[model samples]
Target: MQTNHDHSDVTVRRDGHIAIVELARPPYNYFDETLIGHLVAVFEQLDDDASCRAIVLASQGKAFCAGADFSGGPTDPQMPRRLYRHAVRLFATRKPIVAAVHGPAIGGGAGLALVADFRVTCEAARFAVNFNRLGIHPGFGLSVTLPRLVGPQQAAMLLFTGKRIDGRKAVEIGLADVLAPDGEVLAHAVALAHDIAASAPLALMSTRATLRQGLADAVLAAVDHEASEQEWQVRTADFAEGVAATAARREAVFTGK
Candidate 1:
């Protein structure tokens, strides 16, 4: 069965061993500064609780997240620092995070999907790393994670071109672990969480740790890369192009500044 939870712009429901964090911003769930703190707060709450071993991030919207809330103007100066802090916490949480991608996961939203321990996506889901299109450098450990997933070559193509891949392709490319019907991604992620929850907790946590040791370095390295890139972009003319296009809801034409 389903349960309803009401938070400011997010809803969190916990039942037995699993918790679901729903991005309830309709039409688009692109995170704002407040919502980012909400994300960190919910995850922190889950981290402290022994009963909640699994989390599924889902959304009730046309998009899983379009990226950071570009509609608000410029990116937060403190966001990179905060993003890295939260990423470190997520890595060390030991609890498994599962993402149920219902629609477009673009830019930082791509980072959110893969930030989870496991990911499931809808057949209609679209994934893109459009930081280049946005005239911003990547954040959320993408410099390290993208190369690990699609290899540096394919990752370069996607990052530079800002092209989107469908869920079927995402699964085939090893980006999505499971593919479900458009509205059925939450069910699949929940099922996966239940399966993980049924297993021995200590054993699962140990395995999760073993797999994440390498990521620790990557996370730090990505923070550096994203910082340098964003610092440079803040001084560029092309960044203006990206911001204008995004605000106008049109295509960005970056001149490679």
Candidate 2:
């Protein structure tokens, strides 16, 4: 195993042809611009490394990622715009990725997992797109990826209700590719990555590119529309109520004012 770069928010280590890229934040692993930037850098580096053919995107925290840190720190209105710029780069990466989702992946976090080529999850994992519940349009290119994975009808159900589903249900719905035992999510993800890595590297890249043709471009376009919707929604009275209610752990009573 070769240990390459270790940053504050992410760590990149290579085992044979599979690179294990782990998010370092503990507990919830709430994302910010710094974390996203670090991830983009790591993925880009691994793309160029001939020794790394595939990746397992895992997290150290209890939750794979609970989404953005909306607990109020930066007041910058352009923050999501900046974050999506980095996120789009993730979709452009050439190597296949398998995400190990052992816990909650909510809102944009669910979007992050979709960036992977496949997701390996356990029953303990929860996946949701809670943007509508927060009175905002979904971002992180989920507007495109989610529907592409699970069809528009199921995607609409998930987006509108913001309901969380367990890993087994996610697999049944095609949101996750593999269902693993509770503690073996990461191992299962790495095993999947290894399977991809064992293939002929050049052919694998070519085949993967052919399979995901235009996906990055579609995600880029979708994010533009998503950001525009979110901008207006952020100004709504219901947005504030949604965030507050979420923090308070209560059902949000949104008035479409």
Writing each residue's lDDT as its tens digit, candidate 1 over 1-257 gives 35655467878887679999988887778775567667777888877888888889888879998877766556656666666656655555668889999899988788877778878997799999988887877887888877877789888988998899999998888888898987889999999999999988778878888987778667877777787678667567787778889789898787877
| Residue 225 local lDDT, model 1 | 71
**Local lDDT at 151 for model 2:** 100
- The C-alpha TM-scores of every prediction are 0.90, 0.97
Writing each residue's lDDT as its tens digit, candidate 2 over 79-187 gives 7888898999999999999999999999999999999999999999999999999888899999899999999999999999999999999999999999999999998
Which candidate achieves the best TM-score against the true structure? 2
Model 1 poorest ten-residue lDDT run:
84-93
Clashing pairs in 1: none
Best by lDDT: 2
Relative to the true structure, how large is the alpha-carbon lDDT of every model? 0.80, 0.92
Error of 2 at 79 (Å): 1.3
